[model samples]
Target: MKNIKIKYATTFTIVVLMFANVSAQNKSELLLQSKISGVIKKMALEEKIAMLHGNALFSSGGVKRLNIPELTSDDGPLGVREEIKRFDWNSANWTTDSATFLPNGSAIAATWNPEMANKYGVVLGQEANARKKIVMLSPAFNICRMPLCGRTYEYYSEDPFLNAQLAVQSVKGIQSQHVAACIKHFAANNQEIDRGEINALIDQRALREIYLPAFKAAVQKGSAYTIMSAYNKVNGYWCSENDFLLNQVLKKEWGFKGIVMSDWGGTHHTAEAANNGLDIEMGSSGPYDQWYFAKPLLEAVKAGKVSEKMIDDKVRRILWVMYHTSMSTGHPAGSIATEAHGKAAYDIASESIVLLKNEGNLLPLKTDKIKSIAVIGDNAIRTFASGGYGAGVKARYEVTALAGIKARFGKTADIRFAQGYKANYKASNSDEQNAGYDKPDRVLIADAVALAKTADVAILCIGSNREYESEGHDRKSLELPFGEQALVNAVTAVNTNTIIVIMAGAPYDLNEIKKSCHAIVWSWFNGSEAGNALADMLAGDINPSGRLPFTFPATLHDSPAFALNTYPGKERTTEYKEGILVGYRWYDTKKIDPLYCFGYGLSYTRFTYSGISTDRKTYKTGDKIDVMFKVKNDGKIQGKETVQLYVSKVKSSVSRPEKELKAFKKVLIAPTKTATIRISINVNDLAYFSEKQNKWIVEPGDYKILAASSSKDIRQVAEIKVMR
Candidate 1:
């Protein structure tokens, strides 16, 4: 009795301390709010209005009298963009502005590691600070709705769960450095075609399950300080002025405290945007004061079209963000393009190179035996640090594939290169923009074939570049552009020891290559150290561990959007006909096999799965399901494996996907060693958003937990019952 009483007393003391901490935090927040209110009251209507609009290309106005600094921003889904002229898109010509270019979004997602995402964010945030900027417009994580979405490289994965995981960590990582991470493209904004005008009509359930989770997680869990409204419309309403999305969903429902800024020239009306939830207007055209949120907003307030209270609220939010960023205490002095930042880029790029195929044990090239290496294809010499559309980094330096190879193999083997095909792509308004690009050059092919014939091994570097897989326009098809197919055929015919390395950001038609090529590697528009990372992987300095973030369809017609004829829709509007069944969900449920399934990647080593078990057979709401399994490395080298956990509901009353990803972990294991792994999932996460009830509902039923290497590679399964 005495012991039990002491335990109860101890629990009570801990609870009291927790409540006290919460109370103190609440007091601090209230104080901050009071201070913000004081500042807003002293500001004139014109000053308050100015705070809501751009004073420069990448910055908003601030009251100099009040000592408030303008909130500066930088374009950052890949890395901090080069400093541009204050009034135009021209470069500022600052030699010190070069930064370390981190891997793109899809490449980061390919690792399927949230920890890596956090590291990516830290690099971005630190660089933003180094540039003396407050906001980093980054970590764009729109769902990969289609393989040819143009910005697929800039986005994350097809799975909402994966996107949410990465988004949360990315946000936390960025904000940790006292720089705000502006998670972007607020709603759908999935396609680049007619992006500013097209309306996306999506059902509530689909929005909840497939589209909105990442943004929601970034706001509530990651505590992101800013969000950027997309250029497109969601359900007939422009995202910048959408009452339901910006006001109802983001601010009220999810309790987001950040400011909502518009995409470049994305604002439409002054009153509508101000009355809605938009806090800042950026990238709009015309005079700085004439922008929608500038002089127009002040006039709107004066005319009683938009309330003064709304303007004050917008200013308050802006100041709140400022206090957290530029005005924050003890902010770290950040460094840019440092050696450590370069290593971070290298680490992400190294883990991101996915090995698609390694037939005949041809990888981990026998460096000791090779005398000469023939590196072919334009990608070998191409620099991806800058070019194309959207955001491009002014990389301090970018190591090309050929450069990386020579650095790694110069002492061991003789290396030669031939530009197998011309990129031939230049962003323009002419007819040649997307035309006359794929035809292979016979002369270049002949040179490549001759080099391959004389070399002991040939590395054929081929695939899309920044210009081909850019942001302004989607690819017409998935075929290898720039006559790459013809180049591959010509080179491989002469050299049977050819290894194909695909340097691209999105999926392409690889059906032909999969059959013809004995080895294949998928590399992205990786950042500064792209070549170094690729060289290290090829030389077995580090094993390839990246998995496909989206399913690679066998054909364009096989994808859900194309199969249902709903993509790019009709009459300036598109319906999400595929609904919640996206990516692997669609393929798995429809029983269509993808060229490469989501979470699929190959390694030089092999792993075996066994001993799957759960802590309990029954779960209730709020319960955590603990899953345990064993993975044994069965190869001669060390490697990392991503363990994927998927859940399926048996005999559901409502329609559901075949299975949904619930949890995943990336584990590194030494050769011939066994490692026990445990992952836990919250029961609340299994709940589905019910449109009829307008709430999440967890149905009582039998759930099958599948442990797998990839979506289609289930290794073990355990059954559990959920009780209401």
Candidate 2:
């Protein structure tokens, strides 16, 4: 009782101080408010339409005779999309940055690494600041509804708890640099079919329970600075103008203070969009909005249908971001061509890769034993083939796998190359592969295998193309694109010493490769310097430190969430049966074994975990526990290991994931060196949504904390009781 009183008093005092300050600043707030009011007052129909007129990435009021400041904006979670000379918004120029895609949110959640996600944030922030972008349309927090559905690449795993935790960190990272991070696809944007017009028929419980929690987590913990509304309508209402979602749920309920922007070309009706909580209508020739806001909005205020306070609220939010983004001070985002910064982009790219399989010690090939090597695959030579979507900026130079390997080996190694597969095997970019970020396929994979037969080691690059694993669509299955699966089997059949490098952007099932191949390396679209990064890692010049971002299901059938979809459901649609059991959670909860569970990855070397610690006999409200562990890289090369942590809700009233990732930390240790990792978990970390309590309530009973190198590999467990 006493503690609660103290807390309430402190909060009350703070609120009082804030209210008083606002009241005192009424004159200043009023002056700023009047600035908006004058614009509202004079907004004639034509002048209003002019206000809605947009530059490619921002907006301006063409009442230029009356001196109007242009409102500036930019591209999403990555950075600014400036229309530079030769940089046309209509035509993409390949641009590579220090930015690397952290596994989709789902895969990131599987790692359960908050600190690591925060590190990703730091890297993102540095790049966003460097690029002078005001808003990043990233840290996508949409719920994964069904499998066989495209665009899952844009979301984290299906679990809301996991998604929320990682998103908070990513958001914090971008904001740390000044620009706002957008947690997007507001309300259920589960599928991409007719995305702009699809109605997300959602029930309130589903919204509050599954789709909304991730947003709640980010808003509450990370203080996400911006939200991008989805293209779809929820419960028959457009996301941009959905009052229940934007105003009532996001603002009134969650206290979200960030700006709300429409997904590019997502806004439908201009007046309704602005009338709701939307602050900016992104990426449109929005003259309609200018007229709507100027004349209609002014009328709304005059007729008392809406308050001027709302307009001031929207514009104030925009100004707050503009002043904070501070575009003037930082160096302008330069072209990667002829620049030193481009080197850093490749460095980060190399570091982001996670090695999934190494069998029969096929990796770190002996430099001397390799008399001949065969590099075969369509993506092996195609620049920007693996890297897809968004801004596909071409480089002044590109390093192909064949070229990089040859350069690395020089006189010591004789390397032969073949087009293992055509990036577009169909000879046309019209099939499923060609339509998305598709690469040519293995119509010529046979010849590559022919070369594979005589070589001491045949490196087979078979996985996905840009069309299959990009921002516009989600992969239909966890299998490698085209007939790459068959190519892997056939190549390995002809040549036993084949090393398959899966150049993909998402987790793919490789049961055949896993069984037959000597080794497998997962390269999630390594950018401009992809070839060099792979060569360096393969040559032992750099240790492979990337970890799996998402789970590699044994088979598409093993995926619990999607299996229930019954695609083209009985009603000729789908079902989200296993609601929250997305990714490995479903497998773990139901005790199904996946081909490769979440957090599954291997290092060139090896690691062992020991010495787990948590200094507590019991946890109560406001309690925190410190956990310490040791990771020893027992291999010949010095390596970095990510210590993953997970928490489980025991005996929940509602069914729950067996374990939920709460925290994670990354530590680098020299070969034969033991590094200690200390991770802290708050009592709230073990909390669960209690149906009885109707809130996210922490149960006062027992808790188990597990420390492991990966999800399935639990190295230690400690038991603690929570007291009320």
Candidate 3:
């Protein structure tokens, strides 16, 4: 009798789950049939209004009920965003803290390997779910509007393919934990000038090809639960209320089964946003939501301007998402923890940092007599400086280089400190912009130089700060702050053992510093345990394994589209004349030299790639080509290798990049050990977005597939023919 009862219960559970799975497949079926919809219909106007106002509420360890409605959210993709921000009780229902100080998205994009990105998402998800957050408002896909754009750090890259691939893979990882990922800043929101009002008047060709691909890709492939519309207008209509953007392209063509949430302060009018499928007004509580969510939305319904069906659809989508996340896979919500999260962040961030330049055999520092170490730059001590402004810089802990050194070598070692340059630039809140701090103090560099003369090694930490780079404003130039270059020049002159570390969101000009500094590390704003990670790399505790996420141009002027001027600016037009030639592809195709190539990073260990062979010499429309290469460690220490594969179209309608990165992998090998890697490529990898063709066209031709350690360093070569 006991066994029979247990068997019946198991059968009932399976049938229920099966029913739920089938119910989820049909979006409309769930909208009409789910009990959540009926409850929504029975709700008073105020109760129904509450569902559309997405307020920031904290619940960790388990679920919390709200008399209003409970919606969850998190920070950027590199990690779970901090949710301690306070909300403006007046206008926006969303959190006003607006500062979760997460690492920039471009930094993740540089890693190239999707698995690494997905790993980042999973870790972020673990934290979000543990905190009872239902949405991760990140995987920012904005274009790198300019080399200097402040928010460039928030975006993936200038290249659409890399951005789309990284965003999609990351979303899959986050959703794996039952949390929703929002692929954001919908449609041509590249610039910061008049961001709340400027129109992005892009032609359809550039819009569809360059700006829209990533958004489309994420919606089409990834498990994106929501999309936050931008503040700016696309063409003529604001993104939050754009009909074609919300309905035609997103819903009809791409079939994004997600809510359209408005960016903080992005809602202009409640009715306009709602009619366009803008489901929730985040952060706003005033005219749009507080009043709108309460009066106007229901008023529209009663007036037949909107319907019970429409309101029911919106509420059902919200409740269904809640239910799905509450019981994701085996674990329900609230399983994430803070333990090991900081450590895991350190590991991933340590791997993400790329060694841009290592010269004179100065790195992997020999520590016998190198006692006196001069640590320069204000950033050496500004722990939270590595992350952005929103969510307010936080971690259970931070690993500063100074702490790393003390932990590794103990306090007995001689380590002198100096602020190479002061980060005191405080521009006014608005463009009358002349207020708090004037410029970076040059006298600080002179003081650091004097200290450097007494030390055997000079560790200079210099780069842009949160003030100069974040979500709202864009950067103006690629150059470092005032006197930093001169500071770098002075420090390296006194101590040739100088290693310059640039801790920033976007890439900066380092030509002068490279000439004098024996070694250089480009550390993107790493989080929490960033210091320990940097210290480990500096002390040779771990091998340096980071690659450039975006192309490092010799000069900002050298960029192909530089002449296009201020993008999405007050002028309302930012032409993409370079078309699809972005990142290394543009530099390679045009035969121009980048200061540092994309997919470029240095490791303490040496890796040799050889024995290039393929499963076949030819391919058709849907065939996959397996290209294999053997990588051997030639260095004394066991280390990892990032094998990058480039697929070149020997001939094309338009000239191609000298070669394009089709696929890559970061493989680990033991000292003197050999590891084999095989990467598969599809037809999509070989096609180009032709403006005239208006389609991704693949020409019949011979293609050269090359395997290399870096973009410029080709190790082995193979060939295949495409027969149309």
Candidate 4:
């Protein structure tokens, strides 16, 4: 009896401590809120209004008398950009500002590992802190609706789940350093053509299922502190002042407590914007005081055109974010261009190189037998670290493919180089400026052929550069630009032991290459360590594991948007007629064959999938569906494999896609060893947004669960029933 009494007393003490901790945290939060309220109350109308607009190019006004420093932001989704002048677009040219250039968004997504995304965020946050930036304007994850979209390299996959998974981790990782991550181009800002004026006509179901998941997850789950409104219009409203999007869905439904800033002159109106949802106006033209949220807002408030309470709310949110960021205690002093940062860049780039075709097993080049290597192409030597329309980093150093190859194999083999093509592109040039740049240069091609004929092996690097695939304009076609097809044919006809390395962000015309080339590799505009990572992969130091984030259609016409003739829309309005059937969904449902399906990739080592099952044959709503499978390394060397799980409804009253990706895991295994893998999916995740009900509805029915290597490479399947 005495022992039992002692045990009860201990339990009571533990409970008391838990409650005390909660109370203390609550008190701290209340104190912060009280302080914020006091600051807001003390500010005059003009002072509060001043805080709502930009005072310079990359900063907004703050209360100097109250010790509130100006909130500064830097462009990202690559790395911290170089410092620019206060009042102009010219570079500040500070030698100390050079930073680490991380891999682009598509490269990270190709890794198919959310851990890499987290690492990327960590690097970004640290660098931002080092620059004393309040907000890191990054993680621009717009959906890749069309392959021709110039910003496809900057966005994630076509799948909402994949985008959501990466976005949540990226946000958490950035915020982990107490630096605010600003998620950008909110809602249907897919294409670059007419971005500021184009109206994206999207239905509610498609918006919920396809376009907005990543931003939603970033806000609700990752707790992002700032959002950048897109330059486009959704339906009939500009995103900067869209009431349904900002006020209703984001603020009320998702409970986002962050400030919404304009995307550099993306603001349209003064009164409408202030009343609708905009909190900060940035990058508008003319005098700072004349900006939409500057003097106009003050006048609107005094005339009762906009409420003073609304101004208080905006100030309160900004102050709240400030406390969490610049004013936060214990914020780490960030580092840039360090060896650790470079290694992080290398890790992502190494895994991002996808082996597309290896008909003769020509890769992992046997260095012992090779006497000379013919390295050809302009991309082999071109540095993509800086030249692009959107955000680009002033890299401390960028190792080109040629540099990496020479560093790796110069000791043993004689390496020769030839510029097979010229990247005749400049950001200032118009689309039609270099009209004949795509035509083959006879002299360059002949020189490349002559070099290839003499060497035992040839490494042909060919693809689009940053200028070809950029932010202001989409590509005219997926054809290998700069007459690369002719160059490839010429070089391949001489050297049968040639390895083709195509580097670009989005899918391109690979039909001819697939037919003629025995070996092919797909690379990206990867960052500073790109060449080093590529050399390691070719030398067999690291196995190729990156997967394709989106589907590669056989031709431009094979894609849904182009096939439906709905792209670039007629009269500045484009309707998403494809709806939820995007990427693999469109291909699978329509019985169309893609050149390469979503999540498709090849590795030197092989892995086989078997023994697929579920924990239960039946489950209720909110129950977890546990899926079990086994993957064995069937090759002689160890390799990493990304196991994908897709779910399909067997029978439904409404129309649905054939299947959808729910969860995935990347695992490494030793040669001849099998690893058992288990992935759990919430039954609620199986539901689709119903247009009729305007909410998600999980129907009671049997669903087919598929375990696969890729979207089209399903290996095992099982059935389970969901009860009401």
Candidate 5:
């Protein structure tokens, strides 16, 4: 056995030296270049085809003779998914696989800080690298089209520019760690209803402006190494085999040199998929051998139906990913969930907690004044590590909100707890299951009210669970699931000094709760240190700095999709008829008042904005306009403020949004001190996608640059002229 091990190691060293010699000879080593071609030409036809499909549940095969190692693709965006067995979905049951869960996508986006996004990506990438994963299947960039979209928590925001900016930074950070960041769910995969079969019909302009910008940024700016095609169809073709989407738009136009892999069981046809830009087919219907890229592809190539060149190209891209990531980079593998990562998770959650309403200054609660406090709700004491039937990390430890609260105030104050409602973890499988899941129970409500009556102040934690907001299905409505509103009403009736903390993944109806509660905070499904972060904010240890990444519409009818009859479309086909008008664009254009505007958040301290000016009053194409603004922390507390800059065309021939976010900056200021922030906008930022011309058009006109705290609250405006 020892002699055999020595011989195998010796062989591996020789192959490694050969690859290094080829790479050194061709210093450029571009994708599909001489170094990759040399290896491909030597590969047998069967071996090349084998590299194009899953050899294991979450991995693909590699040619051992060529020294190419199997690529271990792990689910991420938050953290690495727990290890699973090679042939099945069963856990590998490894003792050291517990990872640190970072903040969810929306929660990180809420920070409105690109630097923090980069840090989040770095931690995730480091953990993935330590786990020996070459590709971290994450940084999902799907636009949040509807609040009820079950997978909204996994996405960034409705605004394309904001999403694009953050995605670029995240991709950069991940790649910096030598792990390929796979930006996923390409095209208009905005909803989860019938995800595998739904045909998304979107206009070309909307596709460019609203849905595809982030992917574009990931490719052009971030230089992402891999992309995962959405399960749904963009127009009529399945995303995995959509010729125009994958070949024309993604590959040719955007210059995406990365490999395109199908989502699990997302591929349908063999010839169409190979002919299109799909480089790999993950899993398909039935058995592993029946995958579209396996036997079918082999038969096609042998019969001259599909050329051997197509199989070679696929193998080339696969080899490219391996060469670029840790497989060839020699990043060592080990455990990496350190105390610093935990602090980073807690910091991100603290910055993401949005203070929606703080009427009469009820927040930043003084713990000394309150002798007894009631923490009533399901989420307050529950652990939120993983959810739904999708990718999730098995965290080493999770801090519940109740636990964090006790750790913070348990010594000084009497902390009381009661289960207000039972939050169901299991998602509904049928209509009967959904009905029973949503049914209300009077006993839980009575117990909560009794606890609230005795306490001086009640912190009502209420919102949807994994069942109501997760992958595999779309939510029916924005209402809180499981009779949470009834519980809130009953508790608030007993104690008027109640604070509401929404522990949901997305926005929900807050009209009734907003009226009764003294304070309201939107805390997303934060990561492993969620409770500790929430406790810090409540105890005045850290001031909240998060902003709403997407607009919270007043009602479902007010949404662009619902008003335009587009979402949850009939007959498996959904229309993005709302076009460029999504989220805040819809509300601003329709003159509708949303419950909260985009980029809206309240800090413990007050900020005063002034001295908004631009370096140039008129600018031509390619010119950069530097907008300078002064943000002063007027209140007594130290806090961070995000300065937003929006641009609007004065009078354009084509219809346009009222204003779109162009640039932003987050700055920390001392009490009574002012910070001068300078944000520059490129001339190309003024360009709008012109469908008639099939290109971006920078119309020569006067434009207004508005500096603001939120979308609606414009503080200062400067007029600028764009010359041809």
Candidate 6:
């Protein structure tokens, strides 16, 4: 009787789950039918309006009668943010909330590998699911418009094509786990200086081509289910209430089917933001009732200022997202910071470490070649897991560069440590910007130089701290802060064979030590395994294959945005006077040289590009062109190569960049082996945003297709005629 009862219970449980699955599918279909409409009709006016604003700091109201759960969201584009208090921004102090700190957004972009980005999303999605979050506010698609933008570490690349491709992959990975990926800071949230009030006065063409492409792709290709409105204003209106951006471009033109949620404290008006297309308002200060979309929205609906249909539409979209993700369907519970997630993070960091300069093969330091290795700088021992009131994750563990090197060669090599310079860039109560070590620390610099003089090779680990690069404020300049420049120069003077490992997100002026330093490596603020990954590359356990996602201008003024006075506008509004010329495009077009070009990285092993071929000499619209090239790993080691395909119009009526990246492929080849890479690009990719027609138009003309390793390193060129 007991055995029979257990058997029956097991059978009953399976049947119930099966029924639930079927019900979920039917409910999803019903959402598209009159059932959702009927459910909305039954909801009271106040309840309907309540669903549009946050009931807590990270969640919105749900209709209990309809069995819709509150929309649970988590902060961040990199990893799941640390758990917060129920009704406030304070930490919840939950041990389970600790996550696998993957490489920062800039580090991921440096990898130039979309497959890794997909894996990045998968792990992030799993973590979010583990935390019971229906939506992961991630896969931030904001372009790297300026190096000084405080949140540069959170964004991807300068180029729209590269940013779009990686963003799409990340979105696909997140949504695959039945979690909504919220592409954030929608539409020209570029700078952090007066972010809430600054108006980005951009023209339609520049907006379509540069600032908006990644978000567009996140919706169309990634199938992202949610978007977050930026805090800043676009043109003349806030992003939360800008109909031209939210309605005209995002929804109607690009066919974005997601719900648009306002950033924390981002919504200002109830009726205007609601009617414009904001589906949810999140994170207003004080009590929930004080939110812009709370009592004000309820009053608006009661007074007939905002339509009932608008409320219904908002609720419908929110339900649609929940139905697709956590609400209707059941997801397998996942664990945070699993071993697999750790490996993925390590792999991404390993690939993303860029070897900017390795003169005399100074890197891959043969463990046996050196006796005493001097590791100097405060960054060598710092953990970059969380910082600066931005999106951050509390990692279970973080590997600092010093720890990693010691773990790798501690047994065979004697590693000497020196503080070098104190990194005091942490924001303060009195003065957030200039509080830290902005000037040279002579005492610390003297100690570091003395230590360097006694070592075989001095490794100077220096770069920006969290305060200098975090969200909420723009950097004062692109210069290295906290006495890093003086420290590096002093240390290098003592030891000419100094190796510089810069831990920074955006580009910095390397002109100080570029000529004197024997080698330089850019190790972005990679997550938990950051130190271990750096050790692997320095010890030659893995080859360096990362590339710069943005150009390192010789000076800040070399950047078109700064050079043309387009950034940090006057009278609360800034014009994109430089237009579409950004990053490498500006450098290439104006003949202004950059310290390091975009897509520039050096590997331990060398690779050669040859056998460039095109599918056909001529093509028309709606056609595909296959650009084939063979990459040979000429060195005596296995390596990967990023084949970048760029296209330029031979002659055009409208102003355009010298060349734009259309397609790219990352491939690995064994030693002395050649791999043929075929990158297919649609003829439509040649289209430029036309102001006259207010649409993307492909002009009939001859185009030059170039293959290159970096923007400045063109390996091959071919001409193709477009007869439209």
Per-prediction TM-score to the true structure, in the order listed: 0.97, 0.82, 0.86, 0.96, 0.95, 0.95
Candidate 2 residue 297 Cα shift, in angstroms, is: 5.3
Candidate 2 error regions (>4 Å): 1-68, 76-89, 92-133, 139-149, 153-178, 201-224, 270-272, 283-305, 326-340, 385-391, 396-398, 425-443, 471-474, 566-575, 691-693
lDDT of 5 by residue, 1-724 (tens): 9999999999999977867777653545643377789898898998898888888878887889878888779899769889988787788899888899888889989999988788888888888888988888889979999888878888999999999989999999888888899999887788888888899998888988889889999999999999999999988999999998899999999988779999998988999999998988887234666788988989989999889988887787777777778456456453467788898888889889999989988889898898889999988987667777657888988898899989998988899899888875476467665556665678998998999999988988888655567788877887777888889888888898899988877888888877778899888889989998888898889899999999888898999889988778889999888889999999998899998899999999999989888998899999999999889999999999988999999988888999999998889999999998899999887888988899998899999999999999999899999998
Candidate 1: stretches off by over 4 Å: 1-22
Model 3 lDDT, full chain set? 0.72
Residue 671, model 5: Cα distance from true site in angstroms: 0.8
Kindly report the root-mean-square deviation of model 6 from the true structure over all alpha carbons: 6.8
TM-score of 1: 0.97
**All candidates: CA RMSD in angstroms?**
5.4, 6.6, 6.0, 4.9, 6.5, 6.8
How accurate locally is residue 234 in candidate 5, as Cα lDDT from 0 to 100? 84
Worst window of 10 by summed lDDT in candidate 4:
18-27
Once superposed on the true structure, which residue ranges of model 5 sit more than 4 Å away at CA? 1-27, 30-32, 284-286
* Poorly placed runs, candidate 4 (over 4 Å): 1-27
Question: Of the pair 2 and 3, which is ahead by lDDT?
Answer: 3
- lDDT, candidate 1, residue 438? 78
How do the residues 669-694 of candidate 4 rate in per-residue lDDT, one tens digit apiece? 99999999999999999988998899
Error of 6 at 397 (Å): 0.3
Report the C-alpha lDDT of model 6 over 1-724, residue by residue, as the tens digit. 9999999999999977866777775655654656667777788888777788999888998878767779999886768888989887788898778899988899999999999899999999888889999889898868888889988888998999999999999999888889899998898888998899999988888898999989888999888999999999998999999999899888888887679999988998989998898999998455888677889888888889899888888888887787688765577576789999999999999889999999999888988888889999999999888877577788878999999999998898899899877776664333655565578889988889889999998888999767668888888788888878888878888887899999988988898767778799999999889999999899998989899999998999998879888788888888888789888888998999899999999988998888888999999998999898888999998987888899999868889999999988888889999998888989998999988889889888899889999999999888899996
For model 6 the TM-score comes to 0.95
RMSD of 4: 4.9
530: Cα error in model 2, Å:
2.1
Q: Between 4 and 6, whose TM-score is larger? A: 4
CA lDDT scores, all candidates in order: 0.92, 0.65, 0.72, 0.92, 0.86, 0.87
Which of candidates 3 and 4 is the stronger one according to TM-score? 4
